[model samples]
Target: MTHRSSELSIAFALLAAAAAFTALPQPAQAQAPAASQPTAAAAAKTGLVDVTGARIHYQLYGDLASGKTPLLVLHGAFMSSDAMKPLIDPFAASRPVIAVDARGHGRSGGVDGKLSYDLMADDAAAVLAKLGVKQADVLGYSMGGSTAIALAVRHPGRVGKQVILSGTSRLDGWYPEVLAGIAHLTPEVFAGSPIETGYKSLSPAPDKFGQLVENIKALDATPFAYSDAQVRAIPGKTMVIIGDADGVTLDHAIGLFKLRGGGDVAAATQGFLTEAPKARLAILPATSHIGIMAEAPAIAAMVMAFLDDKAPPPPAF
Candidate 1:
């Protein structure tokens, strides 16, 4: 059950976890390849935006005037825009929300090379530019969260704020079991699983499933991580959200928060902050990594409040 500790992984585990957290057997609606043709009954606008060397599929909810700042959503590994639709809808009513399918996942296309967080982060910024959005509050779930961290690091000017859910900065931030689960994600292991099925059904190039698996396996089997200094260098507000039993360990989450200038509370100042925390952490009770997005309504409320600088004061523990 051992894997190369340096190897970066998590393609299968995310999709597997999605199934584990299934509330119902809802079918995913297919998205058109381009945004030119908006379906009559579509709540969200779907289309493809050309990035450096790939076409990234994206979905938009609400109009630009919905709010001053738009929320850009990044979906996890092995998932498409369909998976993030539910979690982002509630926020759409009040503000603009954009969900993107990362390279090689959902209906997006990928280059014939390795996948890295920096590359994906660049793609995200490019997609925003293509859509006429200069700044946005970035929110990434699972692997998407990791991408959000990278986005903030490389393109700080494009990101207004960050909300990382079920994501970690270092490879070691994940639990041992969680690492193991993602490390063993071979094509055979996911042959008939929902993850594979969904990919086959939604991918623009259905025949590229094996290639996608190999790319993900390579990504997971490699050492792709951001340093604490790199994370600390990101200049913006960040919120770290996770479940009590999430894939990321509490200690690691705290470490990330502290790097972002959080966890300085002490008795000297009565543990009260004269100013708000640049980095905030929220661990939901009785929640797990797989079901974190399902708690989107609550998560959205907190994020909206944080973005508006109206977050409630922390309770004494």
Candidate 2:
């Protein structure tokens, strides 16, 4: 055949093959790999509850079937419910755990005015009431710890036991650097940081990031001071855990324990009893302020033992 004719034949053959391929029934698309099951920590049931005037976002791990006391967890400043992920699954393995994002943080709605510990504590109580939880053990870290103390004080009936990690009743318990950091929580301070990124990533009003920072700074500056008398009055069993090198001074933590009827009286009178004691003061060794929560394994073990009445009482000064 001539070159031109051969070319035409080849072209026609290619077209025919293309037509045949097109006519063939297409195989069904391979099912997209089933989405991986959520990790236990991420399997928490999340929801929003109207607590007082603000919408509170929360995560619940485990269920009532565990037959253990429910634990109400609160995170530190500039953090969300996500911050408690490390402790959720492990704690939930034995009991139901509830963690929340206070106003202006995470998926929770913000509020007007400064975010005082009293207001945050009230918010937590409101949330517990909304959840129909008559009483639950309360755990708080840093800012959350302050809120936990307020919760026990203001809504004493709602808190059966209180765990304050890296928390203090007095504002001055914090290191100067921490106070300075709180004072400097402007948008510029958090610029390009996870705090800023997290806020903008999920906030309903991302534009209000600057406002949130301002509110936090204001809250920090405003005194959330609880008197020694006030600390002495909290009715619930309490545990004050602080890192040896924490921003909360050791002396301050001792004062807190003493007010709770822990101090030297317990050590001298009670000695090292075989049973769980009412109040405790734990100064974790080789730890610092930021690592308090990150040391969840040790914290959880200590807390769980105390809650279960399996561990000895906290040592006295």
Q: Which lDDT tens digits does candidate 2 get at residues 92-187? A: 777888998989888888735458898899888877877778889988987898999999889988888888888889888876555655564447
Cα lDDT of candidate 1 equals: 0.76
Tens digit per residue, CA lDDT, model 1, 1-317:
23543222443445665733435422222222345322222388888988766789888887876547889999887777777765676567667888898998888888255688888999899889888898999989877898999899899889988998888876678777666655555677677877778888888788777777677666655666788788888987989999998878999888887898787656226755555668788998777777676676567667777777764566768
Which candidate gets the maximum lDDT versus the true structure? 1
lDDT of each: 0.76, 0.73
Q: Candidate 1 deviates by what RMSD?
A: 6.9
Error of 1 at 20 (Å): 7.5
- Using TM-score, give the best candidate's number: 1
Clashes in model 1: which pairs? 7-221, 8-220, 8-222, 9-220, 35-47
TM-score, one value per model: 0.83, 0.82
Off by over 4 Å in 1: 1-14, 19-42, 65-67, 266-268, 271-275, 313-317
